[model samples]
Target chain A: MTVEKISSLQNPRVKQLVKLRDRRPRDEAGVFLIEGFREIRRALEKRVPLRELYYAPEWFLGENEPALIAQAEAAGAQLFELTKSAFAKVAYRERPDGLLAVAPQWKRTLQDLDKIVAGSGGPGRPGSTTPATTSAVGAGAPDLQRAPFILVVEAIEKPGNLGTILRSADAAGCDAVIVCDPVTDIFNPNVVRASTGVLFSVPLVVAESAPVLAWLRAQGVRTIATTPAAEKLYTDADLRGPLAIVMGSEQYGLSEFWLKNCDLPVRIPMAGQADSLNVAMATIITLFEAVRQRAW
Target chain B: MTVEKISSLQNPRVKQLVKLRDRRPRDEAGVFLIEGFREIRRALEKRVPLRELYYAPEWFLGENEPALIAQAEAAGAQLFELTKSAFAKVAYRERPDGLLAVAPQWKRTLQDLDKIVAGSGGPGRPGSTTPATTSAVGAGAPDLQRAPFILVVEAIEKPGNLGTILRSADAAGCDAVIVCDPVTDIFNPNVVRASTGVLFSVPLVVAESAPVLAWLRAQGVRTIATTPAAEKLYTDADLRGPLAIVMGSEQYGLSEFWLKNCDLPVRIPMAGQADSLNVAMATIITLFEAVRQRAW
Candidate 1:
């Protein structure tokens, strides 16, 4: 394993890592930072390619730091020791966890998703094709052929909200999360943290609404758009079948395309003065309803 | 009719408003800042005790500024017209609506809550005790005697999460929200913004967990504690009647007092790698289940 000491804050690599903080630079470089031991471990478990791992021994909090570093090295990550100040400069969190990594950005298009679902002969797996049926199935597994549940988020602006939604989708046993026209980057460090690294565990794809709608239609998956204007209540909808729950930006409801083209549009009944819920909260309520119905 | 113009940022009242940004001064003064036209309007609608109203004519966006100013004056609020720089110094939001207010802090103890609930002969009305049976009954009213749903949040630290939960409780038509041992101030500006002024609409009380739980037990309200470790799924629990959903902080699960003393403990099913959901999202899922069951 190659190990190097990065002592200067002005190092070109450190400058590049700092630039990755913004969306444009991350996109341009096709890489993003993953901080914290748990997040990095999740990424490695999901086989996300790691270009480099930076750690500050003095600031490292976890007991298994050495083992985790060894594991990362085994997984082909070039390890580096960062000075305390240099580590602080690259870390996003207030209390540094003493570990950060630059991982190659991964993307799955609508077409690529088709291959996974069809090729796996079960629910699609985005990051890896191998069936992780043992660890993936928690209480009871969804009948992948008939009850594949998907979550579709559109134009979501907040990284934390998006990450929380991903976490919920994972908890509710969603087959995948389709992010369409997101205002926030999926690989944002905040997203990684807020998701508790569940982003790497869940199957995810990014595509425009038009193609995604068309793809779901082709696959015979019913799209349910959540909007306040819908007449029917969310609980009244049939979500036990192959389904996709589409949510819109917090500021605006679903776009014209989703409102017009989605198979069903339903609203979570709101009885108070506040017009709606936080988008992530709405997604959890909608997804868990499916979980309840499917279990029955 | 009494609107005095204040041109200096260093004015005593202006300085006081600026100091309200932090929790210490807000607590000491027993007052908090309310910004935005919608928030101020909601405060007025709820008859929240407004000590002062400040507005900048140049920055005011809404057409009803004059009418709102008049209404505040009629309601006994001291009105002030602030210079552009003076208003900018005190406003919390970017692109201020040219409206800000100093509202007296409101608190409700466990005993006060009993009076409101029992006095209304139903779910206690906060602002008006006459019981708004007409507008409060959204779709179908909960049989208040049998099915008054309350949300109990314990030791929640984030102002935004607490506020979002307030919004959800309102959306779910929860009778009242009891904040138990809160780490975040219920009247924090972020909470106010996140709730979108639902803070005014929802009847809320703040007290320690032990007393709150004791009060619930005495009132015959079934306290359902949400914990990841609970075996019973939240949906399966009987939530259609006199219910109080107890939630713990995001970092820690419920305190020993709640876990042992609450009537029942339930868990939201998790099928993915994430161990739990965001507290606000969890509250939405749990409360809406009661809403769904009660609808039947």
Candidate 2:
């Protein structure tokens, strides 16, 4: 198959890729970028539809780029080969692996979460209203046979922190991640890089704090909010059952709404001068605590 | 007292500050840069000697800058007030906070760790040979009557990860953090920022791997090396007693030397497609596991 070639940086597609780096363009176009071999590969594995792929062989660090490019093309993505300078113009990472893809933006509302809560564990399993044996399958499969384990964040500032949180949530086997009023959008290129492509594997949704809180309460999911002023230690809190760990922004912690609404408020003990851990670090610590409790 | 003012970016002092950003100039000058109000305040609190202070009022983010400048001056720091444009030239952060400092570099060998080991629990504590309650009544004093807790990192490439690790170590109340064959220098400006002033609070040392291992063995500290192939889960390991959690680099796991020399090998459970957690996240999880175990 002959691939289209674009050697000039002035190419409209290249210019569009650069513009997609910012949120307004990405949002208006209803698509975002997935860069590097690992990120593009993960998107393909998760069956995320790729619209187009741009490649530059001179920038590839390893032999696997050809195979990944082929796979992306086979997945019905248009292929474009660019000069190294052209690729560098659009590549977000310091070191580009010579592969980048454009994927359609996805959205999930609070209403979709009902399917997750009801799908986990077998049918008629205490609090779950939906039958697990129902024809629910694919990405949101109910294979774990346990109560729903969710992670929710409010107004995280850094794209790197948000992405790392997603990666950590996936590592802990979270059911879903619902970002509430994010300062940095999930589709930021840095977010994709920092997430290490876990963005594709994890079920993610973005919504307002009030609606997420209401949905969690309705689903019977116990909410645990992390804050520095909280009297209860995170370690002392009971983390089992249908749980959603609520984390706050880096500078200002969980808003008054979450602290008042969450079922329990907990603090990770701090012995040092710094008042709090990085949001991503705190999320991992809190989520793994739940993972530890659930292991029993 | 009136502070010396430098309005020109071409001034020798301003040029030196910019040069200090890179590793070679920093090493040659025997001083590293510490920027931002919180970081300088933390250094003052820790009694870290400040050789010089630079300030630009136009860039001050908060009202506390005047008080902090006064305090730095009181501590014998050479003060220089710079124009906004001059300060921007020397600033490392994208958003300059208008405060920066130059402090002389200090070094610590494995032998210094002996002081930490002996200083943690009181005199005659098990595994400690030196008398702790002697004239040791200063910063490394025996405040916590428990076994020595340390964190060791090998070839961590990112300044942000190293800084976050230090913060985590401080939060876990570790005795010290020893960087083994560091790929990124401990004094990198980003490390200072990412640590959020924990750098001053925590006892940190940069050394080679071989001697650090030998010293740990001599001090009777049990080392826990984190790797994906390890059979024992991190939580299952008894994190009590004198402990050192050894973390590897971002790209590669522990080097063969560490994997072979460390006392025990353990892994954090991973359910996601990503093979491992970010080094900083993994460090926090393992250290907090130790913290939780010791709490009990």
| Per-residue accuracy of model 2 over A1-296 as CA lDDT, tens digit each | 56999999999999999999999999999999999888888777666788999999999889988888888888789999999999999898888888889988877677756767876433331122342211121135444557889999999999988988988998998888999988999999999888888886677889999989889988899999999889998999999999999999998989999989899999998766556377888899999999999988
Cα deviation at B117, candidate 2, in Å, is 2.1
TM-score of chain B of 1: 0.89
Place model 2 in a CAPRI quality band: acceptable
Q: Which regions of candidate 2 are displaced past 4 Å? A: A120-139, B120-139
Model 2 chain A: lowest-lDDT 10 consecutive positions = A129-138
Backbone N/Cα/C clashes per model: 0, 0
Q: What share of the true interface contacts does each candidate keep?
A: 0.82, 0.64
Query: Tens digit of lDDT per residue, candidate 2, span B1-296?
Result: 67899998789998999999899999999889999888898777666778899999999999999999899889889999999999999999889899999987777667756767765433331122342221231135334567889999999999988888888887887888899998998889999888887776566778999989988998889999999989999999999999999999999979999999888999998877655388888999999989999998
The per-candidate TM-score of the B chain, in the order shown, comes to 0.89, 0.92
Compose the digit string of candidate 1's lDDT tens values, residues A182-209: 7889989999899988877776787889
